[model samples]
Target: MKLFQDKVAIVTGGASGIGAAIVRDLADEGATVIIADFDEDGAIRLADELGRDRAAPFGVDVSDPQAVEATVAFAVAQFGGLHLAVNNAGIGAPATKLADIAIDDWHRVLGVDLHSVFYGLKYEIPAIIASGGGAIVNMASILGAVGWAGSAAYVTAKHALLGMTKTAALDYADQNIRINAVGPGFVTTPALEKTMTDDERSGLAALHALGRLARPEEVAALTSFLLSDRASFMTGTYYPVDGGYLAR
Candidate 1:
């Protein structure tokens, strides 16, 4: 399980949901991990649970370039080098038609979900190259490859991320820095579950071709693999972890 021994990883939004699961997976696989999130308390708590020496917590706002730069610097300073990064920090947008969507809401979701990835790469790529190249897993969504009603902003951002990911992966493939994006379907995380009533949850479950939502750990498995050498040839592609949702 020590597949990542001697490597260090920085996971944004590592305080909860898929990010939290990624932190645990990387740490368990013997990678020194930095849990970077605006949720300082949650990060600190997880760090404690994982042992301070192996996992560190940082307060980072991914949308802020300066904050993101400092967080990457802190991770490199703490671990002596960087080998991987998971840009998993993002927010959800409301399910509203484009015509009825608030302009401000569009801006907020895009800033958090899309622009933040640019910020992450802006800072992390140079550091990874300086340290001699590494891997990056950007968190897109099933929406990245398709669109749905009332999800214009979120879908737009996710799709944009896929385009960006391909660009980055091609740009750095020769440099040994692989960049890939994960497009998850309906992963049942606390955030998704929290907003659903029992009936709503049932309907959402039935929407997936598998008749159920995915677990956070399941998504984490793909994330961990992408960060590992096992996925050395998998850059620039969007791996959908949906239960064949797009097929239907």
Candidate 2:
């Protein structure tokens, strides 16, 4: 049998990039997935490509508690139960120094990157418990461990996300639910490709010991493993698929 056969999963921000890759991997392994994202059309396209029976599209603003709750409920109502989840929704703040960061930008970054994860945990946990138990992966970043200039909001949110992941994992460990965070370094996603010049990309890649940005599939592989029985004994841990970026 496939790793996630008979499992049901939800991947927020799943229409593209790393989240989309995770959705594909899970669905390919036999899980029914809900592609939740602010990009409704993109979600629909991905879901259609995966086949309607294997995946469904959910339009949601993860920052909204109501929308997040509805997403968890949708998984159960649509697929019968919830078994896995990836809170992959996030946004970057503008390149502003701490003193120059706008209030709205700070709140916006926190709302999507940090608060959304909290909302996911709050709703996903109860559903998972009701379904007997499962696993969850929160998509964090290298910023969670280290700081970056002019990225104070994003950095702060990521650091807090790691703490939340650890605490939630501990809280639900005895209940057979596994919770973990994934910290990825400079992934080559569609958005990055569109905005970054070759030189800019090269500069970021040089920061990693691997001398290359990570592929979305690389991150997806780790996420799928964590959500599967292969990682049965793991919980409350932060796994960094950072291409040795933090090694230095």
Candidate 3:
């Protein structure tokens, strides 16, 4: 379904994992996509693979407000306008107790996962407004709704995103902008795979009521719907693309 035909979108962290999947899906549906990521090479590679006419690579360190603003400018310069965005860039923290987590680590995690979203919204909202109306999806996690041990920073940042999403939605609804959050259960992404043993991965899967991890495409699908006109009335909400992880 070409739900995004003739649209322009900027998806941060679009080089891989759930971000990459969303980029591909948007392009396939006829959206001109901006592949924004800290990994410039990967972003360029994906843009080339998807065809430059459908996608453009943009180097952005979302943690930097200036860099985030630059990405918005790049999208407008390249696409003529902006309409959709997914603030999906995030970082993981080590498995350490709250008391044991270093202050530096806490800052780093929230800087990427939380602050970056705020930066994206700060700039993208204006651009979307210029385009008349649009939607944004912030990448939260299952942790956004619940807490997990040894992940203080990650949990705190995600929880903060929920509030941010709701407030932003209210701020822009009259202006024809919709803002929302997506919470994904553990997906077998490259980063997650690198940290898990086979047994450890199996145990993690079993924690979900569905007894499996979510696929990046699965999460991307929800993001696509949220960003599409089909979800016109959906805003200030958190949609979980979890494999029933929260059910248990």
- Top candidate, metric TM-score: 2
Order the candidates by lDDT, highest first: 2, 3, 1
Of candidate 3, the 10-residue stretch with the lowest lDDT total is 239-248
Q: Write the per-residue lDDT of candidate 1 for residues 128-225, one digit (tens) a residue.
A: 99888889999999999888888999999999999999999999899899999998887788788788788888887798899998888989999999
**Candidate 1 runs further than 4 Å off:** none
Q: List, residue by residue over 8-55, the lDDT tens digit for candidate 3.
A: 999999999999999999999999999999999999999999999999
Relative to the true structure, candidate 1 has a C-alpha RMSD (angstroms) of: 1.1
Q: List candidate 3 segments past 4 Å from native.
A: none
Q: Record all residue pairs in model 1 with backbone atoms less than 3 Å apart, i.e. clashing.
A: 96-150
**Ranking 1 against 3 by lDDT, winner:** 3
- Using all chains and alpha carbons, the TM-scores for the candidates as numbered come to 0.97, 0.99, 0.98
Q: How many backbone clashes does candidate 3 have?
A: 0
RMSD of 2: 0.6
C-alpha displacement of 39 in model 3, angstroms?
0.9
The sequence of per-residue lDDT tens digits that candidate 2 reaches over residues 147-169 is 99999999999999999999999
Sliding window of 10 residues with minimal summed lDDT for model 2 = 93-102
User: Which structure is stronger by TM-score: 1 or 2?
Assistant: 2
